[model samples]
Target: MQVDALTLSKFQGAAEPNERLPMKVLGQDDFLQLLVEQMRNQDPLAPVQDTEFIAQMAQFTSLEQSRQMSDDMKLLRAQASFQQGVDLLNKEVTVQVGEEEPPITGTATELEMVDGEPKLLINGVFYALQDVIHVKAMDGSNESQSKE
Candidate 1:
């Protein structure tokens, strides 16, 4: 008996024509399942060598580690971005909203996460952290004078 490799088309067969298919990357579980199936269906007369099985197990372990590292890096990046946004709070900032439009300058009032990315609220508008061009501490004297 021969086993066929899994493909994305197999998963999309029941979907509507107009619907979009999500891209799926095979992870550790999928890899382990394939390895188990291969072992179960191997020829009795020509059994797989011990070294080959060991090699496959090693490969699976490496794949799992790589996936974990990727997840950790993504989390680290998000935290760093959020920290940068927090540091900007209550500070005056200059941001470029568009190429043709003039830069907007305002005090960073709030920090929010939009679509899993950090955004800084300024003058009732949300701007991405990357768009910020300059940052300065608000003057204490000016704030006190304005209160009167």
Candidate 2:
């Protein structure tokens, strides 16, 4: 989510090394470079264990899989939210457009398609699903409020 060009540029400098996360994507080449650096700087007597390297690779794989799953879940959640909003049409809505409090007396009308997306149309005005602040039933009951 965070990309910095200056941080990436510093990676090309041999005199200074980055002390934080590198802005550029770390690929196989970067991994090989890091491995070489670690081998050169490792203790001469006590070296890194093979198990440690295997464990690190396993951890990296797990982290990548988790990130992919998290991204998929986010997309699914967004789709579900959109579907829920679209389904709210025909349900009375009470939204404050400009503070006039006119209440735009009308039942949930058909959803209008704009730019390939559905939007709720109430009282001849099309409103985005995200803009609907409140929904009221047409039965005129104060306690019949439902949250979408």
Candidate 3:
């Protein structure tokens, strides 16, 4: 498309214009603003084509839907993480606290919420999900080994 010099100048070289992905990668609001500006400052002798305007509106709708889908996926991910934490309750696991501290092994007795983080309680001690290095089934293996 052969864009006029005046429209290009307004989009790019405007006074106090932002050099960010202002027009090239437009969001919903940016696309709407561009459409509004095109309508407002169009040449009187040659107005914007009807088909062109409709196409721009369709593009805006697609952009809005994609943004909505992104938000929904984020929400779903958070919910899944929380559910995984809840499932750890009463399950025996090996937890590696840090470099200085030794790994702790015990059944996950409960889930504790400490400052928005999910903590697993093992014998009155609190540990985050990352601390859980491995999960082992409590099938009397440790008890039988202790008898040796």
Candidate 4:
């Protein structure tokens, strides 16, 4: 019988009770089931030894552990990349807000950093991530004049 990827994944160990129908993760049960099935269908004179079974199980365990570790590492890397992107955007001089290209006008009032994102307080109005465009630091002279 030919088992496709989807079919193989859903099949719990043939040795495992029906109550334990679905295997949570690829594990020893699956390996044992495959081994049992192979022996059951093998020639009457030919049998797989215990040593071979142990070796195969060891190899499967190592492979499964490595796969799980690699998946975790990938998730960490993705999170780090996302954080770096956010940092770069926070330090940017300009930001694209949606498809609406509002003309770059008005002076920035208060510089607000919300959720690690820098948003401009423009024309005494607060802007969100999708509202602001050009953002620059106010010169000391401009700040002084504005204060006056």
Candidate 5:
């Protein structure tokens, strides 16, 4: 196949005025497309080896698995945070609202998710889980209390 100037320009990252720019990150589909293009453009006399192709496929699979693991980890963390907030319900907690303001001590009345993060309702006010400095069990038993 004879390569034309227009086709060469496309490979050179040249785009038309109205065309959208290429994505910053190459997705699985993009990787497959590039692989196919490489195979199509390779010289028939010296084609890509089977081992090389297999290696590429392995790399692609690894990338996909890593992405899935990352998503799963995020979900796990979110669920754990939510569980922590739920456990605090009806339990007295000391929350530092701000640097200058005094810490407020109140029972965690409700648990809510604000912007995908767990928030505890204490003294009719919603505060992030990080703001809670200390927690005290209502049953007079000393439980896990975070102080700092």
Candidate 6:
């Protein structure tokens, strides 16, 4: 019996009865399940040696570390974006509303969550952080001049 990657992934993360997960990703439980499945389906004549199993365990640890790093990166990126939005408060900004439109200048009066993206409120108009190409102090200085 040959197990494909898609089949193995689907079979690994299934929850037992009385278990509930609003969001489920492959974790230690799934890793152990995969290991068990590997052991179960191995040839009886040439069973996996202890050293190979240990290597698989080490690989699982590496997988876990990679997942943690990925999650950390996502958190760092979100923090940076929110900090950028927060930095814009009460500061003069040059916002590019459209590809063809000229850059509009105004004080960022507020920041709001729209479509899960940070938007800057400039003189009653909302501009996406992605659209704002430049940021500077309100006083024409190069540093963040005010938090208010």
Top-scoring candidate (lDDT): 5
Model 5 lDDT at residue 103: 96
TM-scores of all predicted structures? 0.77, 0.51, 0.60, 0.40, 0.82, 0.68
Query: Candidate 3 regions off by >4 Å?
Result: 1-30, 99-101, 112-117, 123-126, 137-148
- What's the count of clashing pairs in each model shown? 0, 0, 0, 0, 0, 0
TM-score of 1: 0.77
Cα deviation at 122, candidate 6, in Å, is: 1.0
Candidates 4 and 6: which is better by lDDT? 6
Cand. 3 Cα-lDDT: 0.74
What do the candidate models score in CA lDDT, each in turn?
A: 0.82, 0.66, 0.74, 0.56, 0.90, 0.81
What is the number of residue pairs that collide in model 3? Answer: 0
For candidate 5, the per-residue lDDT at 111 reads 95
Q: Write the per-residue lDDT of candidate 6 for residues 18-89, one digit (tens) a residue.
A: 566565667799889999999999999999998999999999899999989999998788778878899889
Q: Candidate 5 — what's its lDDT? A: 0.90
**lDDT: the better of candidates 4 and 5:** 5
| Highest TM-score against the true fold, candidate | 5
Q: For model 1, how does the per-residue alpha-carbon lDDT over 76-131 read when each residue is reduced to its tens digit?
A: 99999999899889988778877888888899999999878999999999999988
lDDT of 2: 0.66
Angstrom error of the Cα, residue 62, model 2: value is 2.4
Root-mean-square deviation per candidate: 9.9, 8.5, 12.8, 13.1, 10.6, 10.1
Order the candidates by lDDT, highest first. 5, 1, 6, 3, 2, 4
Off by over 4 Å in 4: 1-32, 43-45, 93-148
Rank list by TM-score: 5, 1, 6, 3, 2, 4
| lDDT by residue for model 3 (1-148), tens | 5677556878786554345344556577767788899999999999989999998788778878998999999778667766767877767867887778877788988886665567888878888877777765567453211100
Instruction: Report the candidate with higher lDDT, 1 versus 2.
Output: 1
Ten residues in sequence with the least summed lDDT for candidate 5: 14-23
Cα error, residue 110 of model 6, in Å, equals: 1.2
Q: Is candidate 3 or candidate 5 better by lDDT?
A: 5
